[model samples]
Target chain A: MTPACVIDRAKLRVNAERLKTLCSQRGIQLRPHVKTLKSVQAAQLYAPPGSAITVSTLAEARYFAAAGYRDILYAVGVTPNKLPAINNLLGAGVALTVIVDSEAGAEHLIAFAQQFSSPLRVAIEIDVDDHRAGIRAQDPELIAVARKIDLQPGLQFYGVMAHAGASYGCFDISSRSAMAVQEARQTAEAARLLGEQGIPCELVSVGSTPTALVDIERPGITELRAGVYATFDCVMAGLGVCNYNDIAMSVLTSVIGHQVDKGWVLIDAGWMALSRDQGTGSHALDCGYGLVCDAKGRLLEGWYVAQTNQEHGIIAHRDGISPPSELFKYGTTLRILPVHACATGAQFEQYHVTDDNDCVSTVWPRVNGW
Target chain B: MTPACVIDRAKLRVNAERLKTLCSQRGIQLRPHVKTLKSVQAAQLYAPPGSAITVSTLAEARYFAAAGYRDILYAVGVTPNKLPAINNLLGAGVALTVIVDSEAGAEHLIAFAQQFSSPLRVAIEIDVDDHRAGIRAQDPELIAVARKIDLQPGLQFYGVMAHAGASYGCFDISSRSAMAVQEARQTAEAARLLGEQGIPCELVSVGSTPTALVDIERPGITELRAGVYATFDCVMAGLGVCNYNDIAMSVLTSVIGHQVDKGWVLIDAGWMALSRDQGTGSHALDCGYGLVCDAKGRLLEGWYVAQTNQEHGIIAHRDGISPPSELFKYGTTLRILPVHACATGAQFEQYHVTDDNDCVSTVWPRVNGW
Candidate 1:
């Protein structure tokens, strides 16, 4: 068997139920981004008809649409090349919603919608906390682009959308809450500004994994989109949002070699299986390649290997986690706590779903490519 | 096409010929490690009688042996689980060799050899620089292990082996040369010490990309086992071992979106296509994610991608490289210079070979998993 990616079904169910309940009490739509858990089974767990979803790529948007998810939002800024695919989905009776950031994008999308027989719903991406891809809320160009594109016959403007992606960089809960509040305010203000121009939007959306867990009481954020909550990782743990036990997915690895003198244990899992986007490595507590666990999912105490290769992970004591009662033996199978669930989960083509026991219950194939 | 991985045959041929010539000048065997390339076609480029090659895994050893390259060495330190496979390879009339550092590993190999009809060659792995997996130089237990295992029928002690992987950490010519020297001396000294035990070591191999590039004057060293030089990357470029021009492999990516307000450019190539391994990030110059280029292979000046998601790369400029370029239009295909060639190359299953004119050539498939 390929060193299959394992997902804890119980943990995922618990996470989804918790988030769904959280949104229910706050009167917000919990549109769980299925990108983090790109499984039909996992998607079906939370993808109800009215459950709005946020997708990064059109491939995902189409998949969810085919699976009966209607209110789909392509959260990333759409490009000219991908317009045709979006048009096809919209034309095929899928209520496809997209995000636009520039006048060029708005114009390109508006023109594309003109070719279509029906209107295309789109969210004008607003700059929130992260300076990644969005127009500033107060920028004159934002209103101009919106007005010009909304004036186009076939283009339907749905409101402003913003992602507090930088909220993930926050070290404390107050900082995350502040970022979320600001994101909600900026998006709401943008909607009000557009409303003054006689344009009313049905939905306003704002989201991020870090901001999702906060007491979400922000105004005008009708929908919430979060992905990593299904499977938290080291980065999320380092942020103090979730504990290591809350993480659902882990890569199973085997010990291949040992350095008797240096007390270094080498495992077969490398950067290929465990991704190298060790974003949390630069934090105050740098977990080496990953947090190591024994056969029964117990965190190995007094031992942490700090370096990795393509197929080999070196293990040693970093914070007095070595010199335990039992040293890792060759052929011992272990699980790696992934740093980024989204990135590490993308490494494998499928997942081996495991329930309470360590037995593989079922297999779930994943979709890849753009 | 999902922006297939491309390998430069011309560049690989140049690097291969250069390494072989350097070794010949110093009267050492150029046993190119097939672990890096993982291509049967690439392995044939250096095959001849006694063209001893090193492999990182038993699967790799089995691969090269089946290709009729009998003088194979599985360079990774062996444990007990691989005994059957090693014995099977020997039984199949392949001159299989393996490395062992612990008594348990040596005993396992010896027991397997006793069960097999054909003789198995074993090499002692010496801790040359206190890396990860090797026995210490002055360990008295090595002699006891060797004595207990060598005369146990159908087992022949091959020699001593040491890898100078740490040499890649060197930043300058002198430091690199010093590292190579360190690798060579330790490997040779261990071989001499073992030979004094009447082991009659026939091959004393010491190698890595850095050591193979500069050092050829190690006492008692008989062979070089470097592999990664086939496809140099940003890490090797920073180490001054190979220039960017010498790199033979790159990922062809496409522009998916652009965001001027955030100073970011999105591409189809993310961690899956272009791996998140930033091993080369902290060198003298940090190549953000990777080096960027246009569709036709023209270099992007003053710009680099700062971070990457699963399937989305967010590129930005430090010195204000024009965010708007004609070549960066939607769906523009570009070749990304990888950060670590071995790690990045392993992420893909197949390679799309193209000549200088960008004409598609033959596809090379690679083996994955343990």
Candidate 2:
């Protein structure tokens, strides 16, 4: 069927190995974020059973935990309401570490842990670049939050972690490398501050796809965590972190109709198949919704999905050239390289894993929703 | 748990009845498009079993058909690859009607139907506005496409249908009413053209949420179809098609953390919970991702989701005012009215149907994938 999520197994392995080699050379533990693919089968290739993994939702925590992943990190800032689910995961003998950036968050965790029997591992999120959530590394509040967790009988101060999400804005290698150093240094600084307070920080984690790929010395960081690296997207390609050929995931769509005069080719894949994350929209060469490709995953120059309705995608040439009749024949299947792999991958329940010959080798089911 | 899709059953019924009354007064059949909620249980309120309904995918067709919905319309342009699935649905005794906007599409359906024992009903999509996929109503190609289907022994020329998608661009009642008339008139013209060729037109369908709501005469239009009207969203509110209070769908999220210096209050609902559809970005009031509301669904004056990561949303006041500590206490659950109900609803596998008192009454599972 058309409008299906396709994963090139060969490219996926190459992408996964690239990150693994980078982390191995840097002498840092790689905690692959399973949030991108959210598939147990996909993780089998990179993050095998028992490998430390990062997840964005408790559902993923429970899923990966059930799949024998003992060490799991719930990367998102924890809320009081999700404590019950976390408690259940811990009760199941999973070493699930949760992150908090505020004293208020620590207070909630402390309160929830009062009723919990086992000690909950808590990590303080350090803000290296003021990118989304997290407390500033230099903020005295970082030590205060760590102390709050250490003081609680049912809580264990795990460490400090930071994500240089701003590195995504960096187009060149030098800037991204600098951001990577800043990410590692500040997160390590937070851990050092906690260490000075007699709270032994076991882990210091920092990463972003661009930052993690940079060959830079990260002195204090013990672990590197990054999602979307395993399935490089148009965003990563636009940022120069990876080439477009490295992108493993794409939406396979069939050309249904076209507006010949307007030079628009309509496909079945809309935001429903290809997500509305126009991550490369700010780049000099914006891949509208996604970059268009041939059925065999070869890019069609200048053609991108310009607009999308719920179930219809409009493919337009960047130069306003009409779609060639031979190339875009009715019912001809085409592939679309996603702007953000995580967002596009989340839109489907399963991925049709294709081998080197572009034949469906297997189907990988994804764990979606919280 | 927070970051869940919540639907107000009371408001949903009210919105459904409003359209039902309008269609009844105009003496037209109301074929509600189930693409918004995609839940059979949700459709039970607006469109019960035996009612004519429209679906975006074959999966939805099979889902609703399994739930006893016999009269289904696969509204998107039919492709050759989907013929097998459509055949299966027909084999299951579903009176499924497929649509085509081009002669190529009609040719594909005709050729695919050759291998089948039963006839396939096909509708000619008339373009009322140059918004999306459809053949122009006045174009001679429309008649040519209809004639091709009529001539095919295995295909039945169903009728003409048009969706005034550009009606969403109209922010006033008068303009929307005019678009509605144009939508109905143009679609009726296509059916009349088919009739002039000695081919009797059975159905004349036309609609869009904005156009469907207008109290106007649709002379030859036999049926009115709409999806988002059952759950008005920020886009509909921005267009003046419906009030914010009329909206039934929202994402319930808990305060996760905040960046106080930047006037950002982080919530658990990001683009993952409330989709990345910025349908109202061009409106006077741009609801970034969605408009914020109180836990009980009361619209907050100026707070809106300003930015989003995969699992984190940054809510900010429109006036750049810092988040008030009292209102945004840690773990305080809030609601977010979606920009596009259909997109937001598609994010979740099930919707939490709430009562007037804001208590969850039931859970309705949705049909998500294609």
Candidate 3:
């Protein structure tokens, strides 16, 4: 099988330990987002059973919950239709916390709370950098939403949380460190506002891979959340958050054919295997779809997957040099480091865990879809 | 649940019927590529059992073969490593046809064919428009590669096949029609070249969704191959190959929240649900990610999914108009017609086949990995 997802367990452990050490040094609980590698087996190394975890979908929450992860945070903003599933998780003795960033969102939860036998734990998502979803920390609606959830008989206002998603754009350490501090300050400010309004916030959460690894003290934040760091990608490397060697996951593909005159080496791994996440497209040194590597996980200098169709990837030199005949011989297996780990990892149903000897030590199955 | 892949059976049948009628009128076989909707159940409508079909991966070949599809064509260029899987299919009595475009590719097959008690069927891929993987139609190597496969005792020289992948770039009917003719002529030319060398070609295949839809007589082409036509997409609509109404597949998502100041409405369907294929980015009307539609699949003019994170899609108006609060109310389900149907379709494990009234009539499971 040429097009297979491979995970280097040695590199994965190193990446996982790096984050754990950073969070421990900062005296903050690390709630690893299992959304990257939605495998109970992979999570066992970092976010073991009984450890708090963050998930993007209810499916991951239920899956991890069944694996004995009691404290879970469904990071994505919750909708009314998903309430029954959340209630079901609560009924199963899982301390699941759902996030809301709008007053209308709170209203939906408030209306659906009546059917809940157990109170649904809710958190107000604060917009630290106006990145994606979340309400502004200074917005009056933030306090209104928190009050609504706290007043609802079937709801428990768990805390205030924020993700500095904009931190991903910071190319240098100083900027990322500043973004991490701002994320903590704004989220803590939201909690401070809630306290002034007689709403005590238990957990103040903030993070993103770049921010979490920034080595800055998140003053009021009790917990940190980051996903892609568990398996660093080209995007993280482009942002200077990690080195390319730290990337744990890659797509192992065999050289299928080549377009000699055009200097193209076609492989079996395409967007279907590498994912179409060109996360480093805007960077100074763009790693097209992914950075190309040897079968043994060694980086092939200046080579990357430039283009991809559904089932074909074109590997070309960044400098337009023709591919060497010996290296890209027919049936030669090559590893492609993904541009985005989470997106690429989601493409496969399982991960072939490789040991230091590049032997398949184990196969880890992962959950996909909602 | 929101963020599910939905297929309108009515539209799907109409699209299938359109292609079937065209192929029937032209007196050619239609070997529908099952890569878009990998479900054997879905293929039963367009490509039914006993009908020759094409697959992207060996997993799909084995899947459809188990469902009684005998004449399977492994379309992607075969590598030496996959020969065992190919042998397994042949051993199971599948009339599987593998393709090769280079001498090295043929050599790999020639060496591995000795292991098989039965001969391996091999086809020479003709590069019609220098689009992707294929030997140029008139290249001297085309005849050389054909002779090599024919001379090998363990291999049977099947025929010539070509795919007009460049036809996707043709934005008008006239241009696409011309590309279609060029595709047919070049592929047929390769078969004719093989015929002159005392090697009788068994098949002459040429197609692409745009090329297959062109109502032109493919003089020497024996069969037409297409995949996305079973469920047209925004890219097809952008190319004038099909209408948006003809797109049968969509990602059903609920409005999770809104960034009112930014005129953005966020949905649960992100790259994880609707893949990161921006195939229409170069078109006159770039459907960012995908075009928006109502829950019942009515096109919402000017609305498209502008950006996406892992599980969050930001739907915005092309004209920068604010979202109408009434229509985009919290938890209101909406449909998104994908930029590329095959890419979006692959993101899901199963399709929620919807009836005329927008109710799910059945669930069709699809094969994912190789």
Candidate 4:
């Protein structure tokens, strides 16, 4: 499989197991976000039987639901147009959970739900870090949104959800821990605030790959939702969240030619394969496009895919030395550990799973697009 | 369609017709590379009946073949692993052309061809403008590789192909023209050299949207392969190759939320939809990830998607002033013209084609991955 995405099954299993163990120890339910891989095989490993799964797109929710993921959470803020699809999934016996941060969004859901005979499971998103979406946890509108959902005839107020995507920017352990604690507190406080208003907020969720992997305590957080941890990447490595060996996904490419004078080794895996995600740009060490590794998943010292075109990646030495032509002969296969697993994995249609012996064992199809 | 890829069918027709007329005037065949759109509908418009098409991956070649594209060229350097797929296409009576830049690549093709009863049409990739792949036009190995293919049975030396990818970096018309001239001359010279060696070189292909659009003369170039011209992008607009109006492709997204204080209006279209290709980064004007446009394809002045997450694009004014919250309210549909047409188009599985009235006329499915 040339120019393919290779997933180290062992590393993926280890990552998933570690997360499961951590969540179990903290007595928090693990609702693994299936949006990262969007593979039923990987989803099964991360989200076992009776476990809920988080999805960013309705397409993913539909795909996973077809694959027997009953409890589906469309994590992204719900829009008016997506109501029909969410309603269809719910009609098909899927316990679909939708999120709303604004009253307008809640109103849209309420209006849409009135057309349906059954209740639509809804969650109020708390803006714990002000990263992307969600209403500020301290905002009075949070209680209003929850009350709106609770009072609605055909909408069930599930609880609250928070993702401190801001924690990804924390490069230090202490900062990540602090962000994790803050995430937990803010989300729990929102739930507490809702409970004070006579609303039964059973679920209080908050998570991010970095925060979920580091935080030692979660006082009131009942559930965690993380995705990238299952397939660690250069950004996670740069943040000291996981070692390079923990990264399961890689782009398998072949050396086509070289620019010996420019010290560039041209590989078939370009931005189209490795993805144009410069996730490690803000870190102490920027790994260009991705870290170059041999076919056997062993890292090639001092080498990186420094530049890329649509279909050509230029591998260069980090120390500014020319790579030997004989060492990187034409047609030799190489693997590239991507900068961001989610972005990189989304580029490919499927993953070529490899075993401990570095032999491709199976091919897993991935769901892409919205 | 919310957070979808929208292709302006009228603009695409204009772009395709312009390229077809230009190639006709220049006395060259226009074999538009389908790697950009990867849609049979778009290919039908670009290549038309009896016209050849170029592809970067065998998956594309197979897809086009299935869609009744008889003549196809796998433009990327062929490796041994791809032989079976090429042979499968060839066996299905598709006139597939494979490219090779190295002697090792040629030998692999030769070895693969030996197993087949019929000959494989091969093209020597010439390195014009010192771009990504292909052998240097002046290199002696160019002749050696061509001779090797010509000498081998079950392998036919088709001609030469050159892509002036470096011309993308040429921001000025004069520099672009110079690069175009050099691209045509180098590729033509390589074909001439092969012809002088008593080998018939039927084709001399030179390409890249910039070169094909700007070049005034092509002495010996027989065919031109350009893809992105069918769907102009921000990078092409920044290079002055095409106007913003000529950009047929735009990601149709809706405002999901906002950070009013930070002057950020969040859209549903993120890197997953717009792509992470920062093609305009080196230009005088970097249009962040993409240029912001209203739902009707009208440009929103001084506003662009400055930053993006997996499924969220943060739109902001180029200046520091915050956008009025009323103008970009949640659920307001917005269109984003991407930086690189190829990279952005590859992110989607289909294109929602619209007419001048901004009414979606038809949905065209796109093929992805190798």
Candidate 5:
């Protein structure tokens, strides 16, 4: 395969170990979100011994459950239609926990859970920084929703979880650290409030890659849930969350043609292969599509994918330093450091994994779509 | 399933019929590109009996070929490594025609073909308006490359093809029509020049969704190729190429949570489900990620997806027409019309195809990745 998702196993191992060490030292359980990997092999490596894992889709939950993952967290807000699938997983002895931020969502799930003999575990989603989903941490509904879970039949209020998605917006270390503190504090405060209301909120979870890696303080937080740290990318590098050398995933591509006069070299890795994610666009240094590198994963000086179509990527120089035609001749193999590893990795069906010396070690299949 | 790719079969059939009628009236062969649909079911409905269909990836060629499609055109510029896959299809009695624009590309294919018994068919890609790939129509290499293909052993010059990609930049019909004219004239001119050099050029193809739909005049074109028209999108609607009512594909999602103060309804269809393709960003009527619609596919006036995360989409009123909280309460099902059909379609593994009556008749699987 010319244009394929390539994973560096060595770098991935390093990242996984780094996260494990950080979480272990912080006295918090590391529930690596499987949404970023979606690979059974990767999940097993990231969360070995069947530790609690997080997922963004029901498909991922089923896949991970089938692969011997016992403790699973469906990180997204649970809707009514997905209850059957969740029930099936829970019935199959999988400890599947769902999150919701509204009374209607909890009531809907509660009504569906009534038919099941086993109680369905639930978590209250709290808003940390207004990034996306969840009820405001200080909102009175936070207690009301938890009470609904407690009062409902065949439902168990597990704890509270909050994803500080706004941490991604912070490119500076201090800002990201501050967002982490706020995430932990807000989620912990919500749990504390629920506890004061006679609701036993046992598990308090808060995470995002930036916060999970940068923050050393965790007051009441029990578990840290983060994804995309195992396979870092240009966005994380721009955020100063990880070194560029720590990026394990890249798009392996080959040059097809070029416009010599315009100093444009066309490659097979387009948006369909790389994904149309400009996550680093808001950063001080915006990688057009991604940073370009040689086949050995060495940076090609200042080369980058300037533009992309459905099936073609135009690689150009950032500093107008167009190299000789010999450097980018047709059929030359190249590697692209993706802006967002999660987005780019989702574009492929499998990853062509390589070892430290760039030797093909294995090909892992990726489960995509819900 | 929430956050699922849904196809309006009635509108899809209408769009297919419209294209077939237009091509039939113009005396040109309709080679609908399968890059958009990537579904064998949709391909049969669009180009039944495999009448020279176009593909952006070798994966699509193999998929369609397995489903009895013989006349397949690998439209993107071919690289050396992909020749094996192309040759595999050709060896299986599939007439897999590839496009090439550079001398190196042609030579590489010629060398690869020498290892095989059968000659490889190729089309010389001519640059229509410097949109992306291809040699300029008037460039001296146009004839030189044609003669090289003629002189090279194990290589057959099929004809010339040009994709007026720049036609997408035209938001008006007149400019798009003019681009179509130039596309046809330039590609036809390249074919004529090849003929003058004792090289026989049979096929002269020129197309783009905007150009194919807007251009009725093609003096030297033998076939028209287009992809996105069969599943129109918000970008097409913004370009005045098709009405919003004609779009056949959407993301079926449900309101999970909300930010009442900001008037934002959080949905499950994020960029992961509906791709991060902001193609309509440059258009006059730019939809943030996609246009909001009801479950029945009726347009929600002035509503759009404001932002997206991995698995979360924030739906808000584009014109600040915040309706009552009851209208977008949690668990309410809604649909999102994508900005680019091809980009969004690539996100799903299958499409939940429904008819005009909102009845899900069948589930069509899509061939993703290369």
Candidate 6:
């Protein structure tokens, strides 16, 4: 299929089961972020009815809502361009919740709610540890916004929310724990701040994939929004949350050409197939392009795709590593581990589910477009 | 337009004219490689009357042939999956010239030509510099295969063709030029070898974007194919072909979020908008993500996007260099230069063309799904 993406559904099921067990053991409600696996088929397997979901864009809320997902949270700050779409989906009987940070933006969402016959649910985004797209944890603006929402017509202040994306940047447990602790504390304080202002709170969303796995308590966190945990990548592998054995997605490609004299094995998978995601470069180890794997799922020992073109991939043997074969003969099918599963996974419209036996069981379609 | 690809038509026209003039001065025909721009609008502009065009796939050959352009050369090694498409295109009065390396592949094309009941022009690829594809220069088997093609029914032997793509990997001009000279000499020898075997050889194709503008001399070379010359990029900039000012295509995106503490700015132009091409990184200097530029058509000072997710980009100052703005305010438009024009340009279905004055000129649709 043009050397595009292929997902392993069986592996995804295993990953889902593992994460659900992890959350159950820790007594945390899992509200998986749907941004990673955008396919309704895959989402249905991980998040069934009564299972909460987190969406990055309102467009995704409409998509999953049409597919029978009634409860959804727009994780990103709602924009004006998306208000009409959000209203239509809500009017159609889907329960929607959105996030906002600034007073200027939150006032707009509140004003839009006034026009609707039905009320709107929203959460104030608090800056946890990563100072990105959120208000300060101790700012009076948090209570001020809560007070405004209390007085605004047709608007409901759901609670406080925060994203711990900075946990992925950490290379060790002590550092990740430090970041995760800051994440849970800041979100907990913001929720308490709004709660102290006589505002009713419904949810306190605070967790990323890395933070979800940490053995730390999110005291005020009500829902965990972990998406990429469904499809582990090299970045996750480097963080020690998931091992190489847990990766559920890869790009299936074929060896189409070669630069033998220069020790380059050209494959059909370039960034189009396996996205040029360098997320794992800062980790203790760097996976070049990605971990080169054989058709049988063994890592191509000593082999690394050092250079690439638009449609062509050039690979060579790493130092002290012996190549498996003299040449990557024509029509050699291979699987490449992605740097970020979400980025690479979005490029394809369907997933080719290869089971533990490596036999394709089914094909699931993914949704795209605005 | 959803932060998709934006093409500078004026600059593309300028690059096309510059390359055409350079080739014309050297008495060489410019056969623009269609894989670069891939847009019909860009292709039509580069193509003069009866202009020879180079394509990497049979689908491209057919697409161009149906669009009324003839004299097409399928540059990539012929594959079994593509034989039928090539045969049908040849039958449609298109002067389809295809390449052959292995005897089995050549015999397969011969069989397809016989079944189609038309004479197909064929060229034997000679390994000039890059040992990526093409047969060896002094291979006795290569000459024997050329001879057999002449005796075969429904096929016309043209000449030899070679591409020094490896020269693009050469950071120094002397090495790149030596690679060019080697390509020219070996390609000319392949033609001489074929002529010695009583095969009528005419055209000798040898050219690359890295060498097309500098080492233009190839007395034995008859035709040249340099497509990337039309839309230069950070990769071409590293090759010393064109500067950042000459890059004709870029992705126009808006800043959607930022992390003021970590100094990380998230742009809407993720890999989906900028593409996953890292071809420009292999040079002496790596263009992280790409050459970051502003909405007003100037390079963004000190701001380089170092990381990206599916729909998110993390822009930071290079080497801890401080930026002027602490916040990349929501909805600030930006233009991102791609590392490879060919790969990034192929991701979009249409281009929003703008003039030098930033005025909208025209919209051009690209043909894909071959």
lDDT of 6 by residue, A117-215 (tens): 566787888887654567777887788777777677777778888887788887778888888889888888888877777886788888888887777
The TM-score of candidate 5 is 0.99
Best by DockQ: 2
* Runs with alpha carbons beyond 4 Å of true place in candidate 4: none
lDDT of 3 by residue, B246-310 (tens): 99999999999999999999999999999988999899999999999999899999999999998
Chain B alone, TM-score, model 1: 0.95
Q: Tens digits of per-residue lDDT for model 2 on A1-370? A: 9899999999999999999998898788999999999999999878999799999999999999888999999999999999988889989999989999899999999888887758889998989998899999778898888888998898988998999999989999889988988998888888887888899889899988899998888887899999999999999999999999999999999998999989999999999999888889899889989999999999999999999988999999999998999989889999999999999999999999999999999999999999
Consecutive 10-residue window with the lowest summed lDDT within model 2 chain A:
A110-119
Q: What is the per-residue lDDT of model 1 for residues B1-370, given as tens digits with 9 covering 90 to 100?
A: 5446888877878888888888888888888877766878765555444467777767677776777778888876665666777777887788877777777677666666767768778888777777667776578866766666677788887777888677867888898888888888877777677779887678788888888889457678888888888788878887888887788888887666676656677777777678887766678778767888766555676566678866668777767665776756655677888888877777777788877787878888776544
TM-score of 6: 0.85
What C-alpha lDDT does candidate 1 achieve relative to the native structure? 0.75
List-wise, what DockQ does each model earn? 0.37, 0.86, 0.84, 0.65, 0.85, 0.29
Q: Taking the tens digit of each residue's C-alpha lDDT, what string does model 4 give over A227-265?
A: 999998999999999999889999999988877778888
lDDT of 5 by residue, B1-370 (tens): 7989999888888898888899898788989999998999877778876478999999999998998989888898998888788778878888878999988887888778786556778899999898799998779888877888887777788999999999888988889989988999999998888888898788898899999997477888899999999999999999899999999999999889887777889999999999999999998988989999988889988999989988999998977766557668888889999999999999999999997689888999999988
Expressed between 0 and 1, the share of native interface contacts present in candidate 3 is 0.79
The alpha-carbon deviation from the true structure for residue B247 of candidate 5, after best TM-score superposition, in angstroms, is 0.4
TM agreement with the true structure for every prediction = 0.87, 0.99, 0.99, 0.97, 0.99, 0.85
Model 4, position A83, has a per-residue lDDT of: 75
Clashing residue pairs in candidate 2 are none
| Better candidate by TM-score, 1 or 5 | 5
What ranges in model 5 sit over 4 Å off? none
Model 2 misplacement above 4 A? none
